[model samples]
Target chain A: MLAKEIIKKIKDAESNITSVIFVGCGASKADLYPAKYFLEENSTKIRTSLYTANEFNYATPKAVNSNCIVITASLGGTTPETVQATSKAKSLGAYVITLTHKKDSPITKDADYVIVHGFEKSYAEKLEKMIYALQLAVEILNQFEGYANYEEMINGFNNIYDLIEKSAATVLPQAKEFANSYKDENVIYLMSSGATHKVAYSTSICLLMEMQWMNSGSFHDGEFFHGPFEIVDKDVPFILFMNEGKTRPMDSRALTFLKRFGAKTTVIDAKDFGITSVISEKVADYFSPMLISGIFRVYAEQLAIARNHPLTKRRYMWKLEY
Target chain B: MLAKEIIKKIKDAESNITSVIFVGCGASKADLYPAKYFLEENSTKIRTSLYTANEFNYATPKAVNSNCIVITASLGGTTPETVQATSKAKSLGAYVITLTHKKDSPITKDADYVIVHGFEKSYAEKLEKMIYALQLAVEILNQFEGYANYEEMINGFNNIYDLIEKSAATVLPQAKEFANSYKDENVIYLMSSGATHKVAYSTSICLLMEMQWMNSGSFHDGEFFHGPFEIVDKDVPFILFMNEGKTRPMDSRALTFLKRFGAKTTVIDAKDFGITSVISEKVADYFSPMLISGIFRVYAEQLAIARNHPLTKRRYMWKLEY
Candidate 1:
């Protein structure tokens, strides 16, 4: 499904959008930028709502007269919502784009632009592709242009990936103890911000998709308020990030706050942040700490696999609107 | 925080409301669609959470004024979440628009459209901003012409929001059960679909931000079934969607299945769905679910107040240049 035209369309349509809409389901909701954040970042008018194609007949956003842009991302391109919304948007006169694993699907033809995600050979590949496609979509509002921070992001990703691999070799031997760490574990919270926010997103995806498949939540240091902050206590196990480049005091305060809740909070950061005598070195905040996220994913994935759950979650399946 | 030109800008930006609607801790999230189904059917982008200002900052969509269609809401221009995200988007050439309590705040200048959610001031003023701002936004997209759906949505919001005057209301009263049902509760799950998806978003927010002031998780039935399904068997309290839409099947499967695990499941929907409902009908599957989402805030807020915590959390607030 990978195509240069999709990337070009992303580059072209990002600026032309007076308003933008996103249609998808499942992890896509959490993985995509918060509408408020994405729209505010892109200068495009944006709104995000979870749509079910079956409900497309209901009154929805008018895409008439070339007023806005509507985009779709579905591995199958057959999600009822994606299909119906594209049809509706087209009828309303809005420009449309499709991001999917199967480009030959009907959705691709209906869309004004189709971005195909590569690596959909299997469920794992499809899941990763789902992430990649949206990342590509979200990052399209790139500030640097021409893959500005892409190289940096790749470097960061590789660094984290390597560290995680090495760490998993050593720490995963304690899989039983790691599994025993939370005897009464009620829930797992993934807290991240700044550079690690996207890392947290990836971490969270791995988390929900793999180990501790217990319900998980991902939020920045700032979002814990407005309501969810009230639930943090000893019963919940939290995975929080400490980024000096992000919110230092709050990250620290969050550690303290989570501590008061009695959550066995595992701080994700460079080993130096751990008050040890060694393992301290300087690396870009975005790159180094990301390794911790990757490590956590590795550990969690191992734990989940030991427990026998597919990283792509095949234990049980769900049926969408056929 | 209120300004005239900003309001004028909002009216002008209505044409840009093709697909995006901005939501946050304040008025931004308060916007209501005529039906939950409508919003669910149309949305293509999703963004918002806390602020670096609110902890939700930077966790949004990209912005480019002419290119990005956008919506923003905040009762107080000073809210960290909206301000920072809005400012960042402005830097990206976003047409910053807002539903705010003031005119002079940073949002008006950055936004192309500014809708004045001019109303009585209170912590709840945020509700007005969210609902009306969203209504105006989606109304601007009305294909019905003469804004029929827009007017219906506005009326629907008023119908629901005003219900707040009654203490016995579904959402408010059910919220009163928080202590009885959730206090000391180890794990809680918020399940939903369609526009009500954010209903769980609010629930997850409360769990993490209020009770033990801890971490929380949100899951859809399909995702929960994929792998996380096994966790629903015990010790988990869940809130599921029993809305009048296609979401019912999966949610029902979750409800029926999760009940076997001893997880407390609350279904939010009309009476037809039974006490199994999660939030309530006033807040349903379409975009206007935010109306019920508004009440959910008060529900959680009242719980927080009753818990005798600080009531207003001021931990991670940020300072911005705007």
Candidate 2:
């Protein structure tokens, strides 16, 4: 849950504020894209932007405003760039809302309002926590705009979480097969649209490529047709994250193209997981990516095992300074 | 150069306008990111967004308004989604500005103002045209706000075009060496920040991966460390697009990390091309990526040739129907 101070701050600034900036580093930064998608789809009154912590630190005072709400998320609460960005946003007269696992980390020091989500030992666990934090912000903003019932939405997330956990059993077998089929292939592509855009990004960059040391190219489905589709052929393996939302048609078009080309394609459709059956149909589209992330992590884990690499293995991440 | 009617239309609505939406399909869609970056870096008065054509068509009246200007770029101007998006923007009462190669194209028919830049036979040439169109819009808006000298900027761009062309000779040898070294490898990484961010994306997806059929991963410099950095090793090759701007320090940090780790890194810096010497210092930062795009295209072509492939070759681009 968000801090009481944060809700009160949003309530106070709701009318004047025209923008919300989500700032973070690494996986934390990718998490902002979905939050951005959520806020953009829900609130037409507020503009949402995703910025990496370092970019925010440099672009501040010009990119942010006194009439803006800046949100930062760091699982460790100690990322130097994020810490600096939060301070910069505060100095620029913007409201700062920070989400971290610890109350006393460096990022918390300069945050105007801090929500401590506690820690997770694994990447997937940390990702889930970050998603919840973003989902909470979406609820708060929607409530502030008088567009939705915040309390009901929060309760609905609990049900959606349970449903996501339940979908793992159904997703695991297919994920295992996919991993077994494509494990030896050095390069793969992942495509998605709308809310699941960042999920595809993180799954490729963070989970598969980084954690497992597999190579990948991930793209938004709408942009898939322009040129990247040329790389897709019968021998190329790809994954399509299809969500039940306005962007579904775009993904469907790409999927049809991929299938028609006889490319080895994996489809992770939210509807297959019965997302609407668990969450209210009204809110299913908003929550699709969060649910998909939970379901997809199983695939990443399976892929890592199939590739014979531990997810914790790293060459330059924690092993080297650069 | 932008047509007069477009300038007059923007000047007329400049007082009421609060947002500008850049819409396109594929490479056209990715091109909007740089334009969005330019507007954000220069003008803080208006909100800017990059939307794919399909998404814009669906977002419709909710995402656009009379107070918004929608800009779409399509080289041939027959992209079905882009044409529909332009029409949809008109229907939603948003001022529509379309960039295409012909005045009578489908997109131009629905657009309030259309600027035809003539047909480009290659991706690089088309990219140059799109960048110029976006730069022209940036100048027009900044001039309308009385924050910049439009005519001087336009004249300066002429000098920049010559400088970028001059840099091609210097970049080719290294590009040829890079292509030879990595042509056999399936995957590569590209990293950049700020204005050059989209250049990295388009270069990876549109040029190397799509045209040459090489696999690549591209990340914003600020975002490279989150998780993707774990994939880097002495054996893994990466290209870093370093620009001379506010976001330079961000790229420098990543470059330091990259070099220290002994990863094979190619640094394509704006300064290396004598950008400041050719372009006015006042406008050099905004012109960095455009320069990079021009300089980088030579490498893409060289790489394509070295890999024994033609840039125009595609498996399904225009060869098949989805």
Best by TM-score: 2
Give one digit per residue, the lDDT tens place, for model 2 in B1-322. 4544566657676656767788887677766676687666556556667887887775442558777788888878999889999998888888888888777989898898877764355434545655655664665466455455465566655676567667775777887887788778768888899878878898888887778777877889888888777777776788899988778998898888877778888888998877777667666666777778877777777888888899888877777666
Scored against the true structure, residue B69 in model 2 reaches a CA lDDT of: 82
For each candidate, report what fraction of the true interface contacts it reproduces.
Answer: 0.43, 0.63
Model 2 alpha-carbon drift over 4 Å, by segment: A1-5, A13-15, A118-130, A136-140, A143-145, A148-155, B1-5, B118-128, B136-155
Question: What DockQ results for candidate 2?
Answer: 0.58
- TM-score of every candidate's chain A: 0.63, 0.91
> lDDT of model 1 at residue B102?
81
RMSD of each: 8.0, 2.8
DockQ for all candidate structures vs. native: 0.28, 0.58
TM-score of chain A of 2: 0.91
Per-candidate count of clashing residue pairs (backbone under 3 Å): 117, 1
Whole-model Cα lDDT per candidate?
0.50, 0.75
- Assess candidate 1 and give its lDDT: 0.50
